[model samples]
Target chain A: MKFHWFHLMSYPDLPDDFREKNRSVWVDVDPNLYDPEVGHHAYNEYLDELEYAGQMGFDGICVNEHHQNAYGLMPSPNLMAATLARRTTEPKIVVMGNSVALYNPPTRIAEEFAMLDCLSGGRLVAGFPVGTPMDTIFSYGEPPATLREKYREGVELILRAWQEPEPFAFNGKYTQLRYVNPWPRPLQKPHPPVWIPGGGASVETWRWCGEHNFLYAYLSYFGYEAAVKSMDAYWETMAEMNIDQNPYRAGFLQFVGVADTDAEAEKLYAEPALYFYNRCLHWYPGFTSAAGYMSVESMRKGIKSQVAQAGSALSSIGQVTSTETSWKEIVDKSYVICGSPDTVVERLEDLATRLNVGHLMLLLQFGNMGKELTMQNTHRFATEVMPKLRDKFGDHVDHWWPSSGLANEKTAQPAPINSELGGNSQPTPD
Target chain B: MEELNLPSGRSAKVFTFGDNTAVGDNIKGDNARQDNDNYNDSDNCNDNNLPLVFFHSAGGVDENDPFLNQLAASFKIYAPVAPGFSDLEELDDLVSVSDVALHYDDILEALNIAEFHLAGHSFGGMFAAEYAAHYPKKVKTLSLIAPVGLWNDDYPVLDIFATPPLELGQYLFGDPDSELAQAFSSLASDISGNEEEIVESIIQTVQGLVTAGKYMMPIPDRGLNRRLYRVIAPTLLIWGERDQIVSANYAKDFAKLLRDSKELIVKGGGHMITLEFTDKLVEAITKHAK
Candidate 1:
């Protein structure tokens, strides 16, 4: 199994009363709460961690986009990918990815992704996310009814721009271009492998991914147990579409932490995990789904399911917005897998075996986790846990990984310790 | 009530009542007793009342609504279901509010009616105002009950799209404990454990909201302020005194913009004025439409 190190890059210094006092941590988050001075350090530190993960022999390093939210500091993942292209020799720099519908002329994304692929020597995993309601409908103000159509059109435009081989005039409902061509075509022939990160609710998205032979990454805050139904649904759709049951076609993100022993790992990870699940995810219920965001068919299918009914009940009563799951509850739900290397491997292997996912995107750096603890977590997991699971899915060809020859090169080296930075050296508080 | 297939693959459900057999014979006789209670029984009446076009609220089309039935007693009523409100896939064909307004014009043309009295409630009122402003000559008389076309920054309309089902009643009615409010609120309730019934209910509610969102999501104003002055027909603006959705304060703004308009505020009514005070609405609509 291939492991990708992912980071949400959340703002770590939320006030103590943020959950009680703030309306939400996204969309309309108070701008005064963001400290650029702190952000300067956070950005550098987060980038250093990604480079460190690349050096630690992780197969891929990923960054994603979110707007007007303290939960994720990267509103422009492309900028981070560009910087990573120059700063690190990471085999796969996945910008998972630009919200295509938000761009007026989506060929701009094709141009930028091409430039990044060229800069990275053809090592790019292009992710096209439909984006969350907060990002697309609320922040960007794209009409909910037409968001999916616009996204589909934008994807078509971007793909054609990258591969059409000749400059062409293109006319689309949402976008129109007199000359539809991007200079400096992608280094990879016919563009980079496309991956779609989704919440797994929309049946159309599942069918789209299956029909196009794209990897469907089930990006969920809810853990593997909660993700079973969606993953099963995707596989069922794939079966009906007559697509191969290659496990590499699926990717799953899970929050993880590791240490020398179970007790020590719990001590090191509990606070940050709680902060992530409780404070960072404190979004308003009303902002969850915009009207007409989901198609009428999808809404009908979703509302009939028992899970959706429960979710609606919770959302209607504001339980999802106000309730903060305790650290114990988070662990019980497996929202985070924290323990010794052996314990972590056992749980992850169980998850991988159950879900049959070939790509595991591990979120190592989460809410308010200090640099030292994050590095410790990353180092231990890469050194101990990853080796045990690397050969589990060895027989399956990973068509989803970067085709750039550099992916197989060995780059395992310990990250340099920065003792001068007090926060980077601080020991995890028990 | 009859279903008429329209152009552009659209369809409308219309309810008609007046007798067309005596159209020219008793035209003047009907004009004389316009104020008499007996004139309401159009079957035995000598009145030559113009066809009344009733538009349903944003919630969805209800051809059998009590207020509409009451109005039907006086004149032939045509309540056409708006696109998107019904579970029709043709909703994708409707791109804008103007498209919806023009479609209604087509419906009128298809029905072979040149001019008529038009009345709409809430979201329907917004569509009616848009229709009147676009084809002023076709609308002989206009009645709007707690419409949502005009928006005020000081007294902004409530975001009903975002409101929870249980709490939506507070914004829609003066006394949510009342029988009518309970009935209106019941439409949103998930009373059945049966998945199919629950799914159907959600689909019904969501489709209506999606239809409404085509014209009023993000913000309710669709530049009606600029078009209201173009409507040359005499207008009547009615408001529920306790309306929480679009505040009753907007009644004055509508009265000011309309060419020859009058305002009436029903004391105990809410945003669902037609549902709560059907008698008062029927009375006001009858007086103004005449």
Candidate 2:
């Protein structure tokens, strides 16, 4: 299986009382709280984490789009991808990606993405997300009724701009461009592989990905245990549509932290995990779904949270927004895989085998995890865990990964420390 | 009351009442034609009562509106449901208030109505204003109650869609604890104990907010402020003194732009004045239309 290292770059150091006092951490989250000095350090440090992941030999590294939110510091993920492009060579530069409808011309994305692809020597996995309601309808102020249509139009415009042999005059409802041509086109043939990371609610998005032969990356803070039914439903959908169950056709994002022992790992990762679930994901209920954001047909299929007929919701499968949830509760709900490498490997393999997804996007850094711990997790997982799961679906061809810059590179780096050498001992926190 | 088939695959649900049908002269439903082949000036003057083109509130077209029922006693009421409120797909054909104005014009033309008095409340008020501005001469008089279009920095509009369902009464009614307000609050949990009906009512309530949000969200101003100068009708700007959604002070914002306009603040009333103060609304509309 191909592993992509990802980071949300959630702003660290939110006051402990932030959740208690605020209605949300997004949209209208207090700007006064965002210290520019901290951001300067964060941008550099976050890029360092992506760079570190690349040097450690992960197949890919990712960044995504979110606006006016403290959790995701990337408003323009392409910039981060560009910096990664200049700084790293081996890893596929994944910007998963810009919110298409939010852009006025949207061709801006085509230009920027092509620049990244050219810089990375055709190592780009372009992602087109419909975007969260908070980013699209509420923040960008696109009418919810027309957001999907506008996105569909924007994607078509962008694809055509990249691949169309000559300049073409395009007249779209939301966007109109007389001359549709982008300079410095992508080095990848036709365009980069498209991956759609979604919240796993909209049936239309699922269908769109299947019909278009694009990789649908189902991203949820609630981990694989919560995703069993939905992933099964996705495969069910693929089967019903007469599409092949080529595991690489989909992706799953999971949070991971690793240490020597399961108990030690739990102690190290608990604070950040709690902060993530409590502060980073704290959102106002009102901002969840804008009006007409989901079509009537989708609503009948039980839109976003409702699609989980887990039957009265015994656990917090979909009720993630309810705050004050404890770290133990989050772990109990299988929201994170924070344990020793053995435990993580066991659970992840189970997840892959059960969910039938080959592309595993591992979110190594989440919430307010400091550089030291994030590096520790990154090092431990890369050296210990990834090798075991590297070849789970190794034989399958990843049709969605851009093929230009990805051969003759060994993705697995087994740690050099010998078994008898005490494994380059570092002092433990007694 | 019947369905009026309009152009662009639109099926407009129109409620007509009172014996004195002014336009199309009492003709109903599919039999009506928009071609204007049998047009007459007498349609506007039926027993000295001008045809009342009533635009219902953002809550969607209710044939049994208390305010409309009272107004029907003295005038013919042509109440048509706005697009999107019924079928969400209809919103695709509308991007701005200008599109809605043209769509409403089609509805009236389909009913074979040439001239009438226009009145709208809440979201409907915003559309009524836009429609009047688009075709100024067709409307004899205009009435807008708690309309949302202008933004007042000091008294900014609140996010109605964000307000929790049960607590919505506080934003809508002057006396949230009153009988009618209580009924609206308990609409989802009515004593009838019919699950389907209760669920349907709850869905309808959300649909109202969603449809209204299409034009009203992220500030309601869809260039209606720029075109308010075009309306030539004698207009009345109505508001509830205690209206929490849009304050009574907003009446000045509309009245100042209207060519010949008057303002009225109903005592102890709120945003849904037609529901809470039906008599006051009926009396004010009756005196203003003729």
Best by DockQ: 1
| lDDT of prediction 2 | 0.81
Model 2 chain A: weakest 10-residue lDDT segment is A310-319
Q: Per-residue lDDT of A1-430 in model 1, one digit per residue for the tens?
A: 9999998899988888898888888888889999999999999999999989999998889999999999999989999998888777755898899899998899889999998888888779999998888888778777677789889999989989988868999888789899987987887877799999998778999899987788999998878999988888888888999898888999999999887666776788888888887789988766667667787766666655543556443232222444788877777888888888888899999888888899999999889999998998899999999999989888899888777633554433334457455536767799
Per-model TM-score, in order, reads 0.89, 0.90
lDDT of 2 at B21: 50
Off by more than 4 A, model 2 = A303-321, A405-430, B20-23, B26-47, B188-203
* lDDT score of residue A51 within candidate 2: 96
Span of ten consecutive residues with least summed lDDT in model 1 chain A = A311-320
**Model 1 per-residue lDDT at B139:** 81
- Model 2, B197-244: lDDT tens per residue? 443444555566667888887787788888899999889898999999
Which residue runs of candidate 1 sit more than 4 Å off their true CA positions?
Answer: A307-322, A405-430, B15-48, B176-187
